[model samples]
Target: MTIQSDRARDALLDAAEELFARNGIDAVSNRRIVEHAGAANHSAIAYHFGGREGLLRALVERHHDEMARRRRELTEQLGETPNIHELVTTRLRPLIELLDSLPKPSWRAQFMSQISAVPSAVEVAKEVIGDADLPDDLRFINGAVDGIPEGVLRGRAYLLGSMVVGVCADQEAKMNEDANKGSWEQVGRFLIDAAAGMLGAPVTDPDGAVRYPSVPLL
Candidate 1:
C-alpha cells in the first residue's frame, strides 16, 4: 500500500481501538469508526479490516505480539526452575510496561480487556494469538499448576486471565482520569502474588480430602 493508504488503514485501526475501548464493540458503528478516522470514505473499515470482528482481531494480534514477546524475554531470563511468582509476573509485566511506555493515555488496554471479557471476541483473539508464537511461560505456568485437577485448573486459568484484564482496565481508566504516575508497579506485584497463590493453592479431592502443595507458598 502507498503512504496515504497505509496511514488511512492505521487511522482506521486507531479510531476503532479508541471507540471500542470507550463505547464498547457492539455499540460502535462502521460509519462512526470511519468518521472518527477523519476519512472521507465511509467504507474505510470494511476496506481495511472487513468488519468489526476483523478490526478487533487485528488489534488483539498486535497486542498479543507485544505481550508474548515480553513473556518470552522474561522466561528466558530465568536461571531454571523459576518460582511461581516470577512465572506469574511474566503475565503482568508486559501490559504494565506497555502502559508505562505510552506517552498519552491509550485505550488499547481497555480495548483488550473488553474483548477478553466477551466470549465471541475472545474466540477471535484466541484465533489470532493461536497463529502467533506461543511463549515458553505458558509451559512453565502449566507445570506449576499441575497439582490442580484439570477442571479446577481451567477455572483458575479463566479467573486469572479475567482478573489481569480487569485490573489493567481499571488501572488504565485511572491513569486516563487522574494522570496517576508509577501506580502500576504496586498492582502488578499484587497480581503476581495473587496469581502465584491461586495457581499454587492446594487441591481438594472430590472425596472431601485436601492435598496441600509440597512446595511452600511465597
Candidate 2:
C-alpha cells in the first residue's frame, strides 16, 4: 500500500479502537468510525479491512506484533534455558510494557478486555494467537509448563489471561480518571506472583472433581 493508504488504514484502526473501547463494539457504527477517522469515504473500513470483524482482527494483529517482538527479545536474552518464573514473566511483561509505553491514558487494555468477552472476538483472538509470530519463545514456555495436564493447563491459561485483562483494564480506567493508586511495575509483580502460584497449584480433586449444590426447581 502507498503511504497515504497506510495512513488512512491506521486512522481507521485508531478510531475504531477508541470508539469500541469507550462505547462498545455494538454501540459504535461504521459511519462513526469514518467520521472519527476523517476519511472521505464511508466505505473506507470496507476498503481497508473488509468489515468490522476484519478491522478488529487487524487491530489485534497490530498489537500482537508488538507484544511478540518484545517476547522475542526477552527470549534471546534468556538464551537456551530459562526457569518457569522467567518464562511466565516473558508471557506478561511485554503486555505490561506496552501499557506503560503508551502516552496519555489509553483504552486499549479495556478494548482488548471487551473483545475477549465476546464469543466471535474470542475466535478472532484465538486465530491470532494460534498464528503468533513469537514461535521459539512460546514453544519453550509451553514445554516448561508441560507438567500440568492439558485440560487443567488450558483452564489455568484462561484464568491467567482473564486476570491480566481485568487488572490492566482497571488500571487503565483509573489512570484515565486520575485515580490510579499503584505503579505499573508493582501491579506487574503482584500479577506475576499470582499467576505463578495459580499455574503451579496442585490438583486437590482429581476424581470427579468437586460438585456444587444443584438448584431447586421453582
Best by lDDT: 2
What overall lDDT, based on C-alpha atoms, would model 1 receive against the true structure? 0.71
CA RMSD per model (angstroms): 5.7, 6.4
Model 2 weakest lDDT span, ten residues long: 209-218
Off by over 4 Å in 1: 131-139, 179-182, 205-218
lDDT of 2 by residue, 113-200 (tens): 7885566776777676663333333355557664554445455666677788889988988988889778778888888888878876
> By TM-score, how accurate is candidate 2?
0.83
Report how far residue 116 has shifted in candidate 2, in Å.
Answer: 2.4
Residue-level lDDT tens digits of model 1 in 5-89: 9999888888888898998887888899899999998877788888778887787766566777887798788766777788777
Query: What lDDT score goes with residue 48 in model 1?
Result: 84
Worst 10 residues of 1 by lDDT: 209-218
